[model samples]
Target: MALCEIVNKIAACGLDCSRCADYENGEIKKLSRRLQGLLKGYERLALIKAKTNPAFEGFKDFQELLNIFAGASCGGCSSQNVKCPIDCHAKTCHKEKKVDFCFQCDEYPCERQFEGKMRERWMERNNRMREIGVERYYEEQSKMPRY
Candidate 1:
């Protein structure tokens, strides 16, 4: 992949923004909408079955969860107009350094922006990108799940 494309698809923290479940029109959104369509009349069936099967009582909760997933939508962190809606420090740091990714900066593993499992994942991804280069990293990350 080209540098421009890679920058657009990948986040400064090494996440593949395009593959994220919350990204606009992403796989999870599409799947959730499809599943919602398939279960259009499931509430009625669930209500009828609830009297007999106690497990069916949780239909509303399940539906709520599905609705949340179905509503997932984000413009991605790379969007110039709304970069990193959450105001991630890493994004600001990268812009200041004029680097497209964390791996490109001199302080590659600054350990300032993330914590716990996220910090670990961030380090691992940036290291991998540094070792293999962004193009190959983008190709590899494209095949992986965001969540």
Candidate 2:
């Protein structure tokens, strides 16, 4: 696909939907399914194993992480069924200003934009997008290792 087409997956808040854990065709979904099966198969065995191995004590935590990963898969912000407040707000703001992306706004990195870890990550991404431009930014994001 063209770089612009790939980069167009970027949400208004600067998050690269293509790189998201829940993004279509991403590894997280496959990993989540595998982990679910493993967890189910190992449930009783893990408890027994934990009695002798301290390492097995983290099985509960691993299960929690598995749940998180399972829930991370998304069809991107543009999915009609999903209601993402951040993306919604960003879209509204950009539309009001008649700008294409958040980076195009005059108050690009305003304090109001930084809220939680997700927003913070997007903010950093926005900075990178500004530094490298969309195509290069997409290339760079695509190169990063996914969980």
Candidate 3:
């Protein structure tokens, strides 16, 4: 695929779908799975150490969190496997309007699927995409932390 096509995982709300924790095979899930593997035998160690150290008592909760992260999988905004935690209106709006990104829409900053810091981010990202184009915007965002 072309670089543009490959990184076309940008969401309608200007978020990078690949950077989402729920993204299938994304970095968060991959690292969580690897860490689970590395800590395979740590359960027994935690059990033994829990008798001597109270801090080790939280191992069960830690394991639960790790499992959640490791099991996380979603196919992005456009996919059927969309597991968005929020009540996202951007995706539906995009589909109805047939726009690839919010920046491409007639009403870019409409009140939908964004609030507080996310609203700010949406405006900034869309404006950046408008100024530099989606490909360049994606390149610039690729070098920064998602959150």
Candidate 4:
């Protein structure tokens, strides 16, 4: 509710805003709440999974990682650390070479060392936006004024 300065149409994650649930609250809020509950449920499952599944043992430290994402209310990239990937090869390489997104630089798809997880997420968001229509979703979300 604090009229935070949203990017209006773009996320540093390369998302075209209108796709965000926070940006389209009416229809989105229910889903968002559901997702919030799901995330919480996922955390619980992760805890259980961490104990039994060696594959998920990496998630043993899930709490710490989720804490970073918990406060992120789609508050923009620069402002939200949740969007900032930890040890992101893309960001590191970008900084080392002095560039922005990989798409902007010479390397659109660096198979040698690419962020597959992040890339997949980007694709998912993009596809969802395309399906929902950016402005349609935005108008719905805009109803819930930030302040």
Instruction: Between candidates 1 and 3, name the one with more favorable lDDT.
Output: 3
Q: What is the C-alpha lDDT of each candidate?
A: 0.80, 0.68, 0.82, 0.46
TM-score (all chains, Cα) for each model: 0.79, 0.63, 0.86, 0.29
Residue pairs clashing in model 3 are none
lDDT of 4 at 20: 44
Candidate closer to the true structure by TM-score (higher is better), 2 or 4:
2
lDDT of 1 by residue, 1-147 (tens): 678977877888888877766666567778989999999999999999999999999999998988877887676666653334544667678888888888888987786778777788788998999899998988888887666
Give the runs in model 4 whose Cα sits over 4 Å from its true position. Answer: 1-87, 112-147
Give the winner by TM-score: 1 or 3: 3
Q: lDDT at 48 for candidate 1?
A: 95
Q: With candidate 3 superimposed using the best TM-score fit, by how many Å does residue 62's alpha carbon deviate from the native?
A: 1.0
**Per-residue lDDT for 146 in model 4?**
32
Lowest lDDT block of 10, candidate 2: 78-87
Give the winner by TM-score: 2 or 3.
3
Deviation from native of the Cα of residue 141 in model 3, angstroms: 1.4
Consecutive 10-residue window with the lowest summed lDDT within model 4: 1-10
Q: How many residue pairs clash in each candidate?
A: 0, 2, 0, 5
7: Cα error in model 2, Å: 4.4
Give the C-alpha lDDT of model 2: 0.68
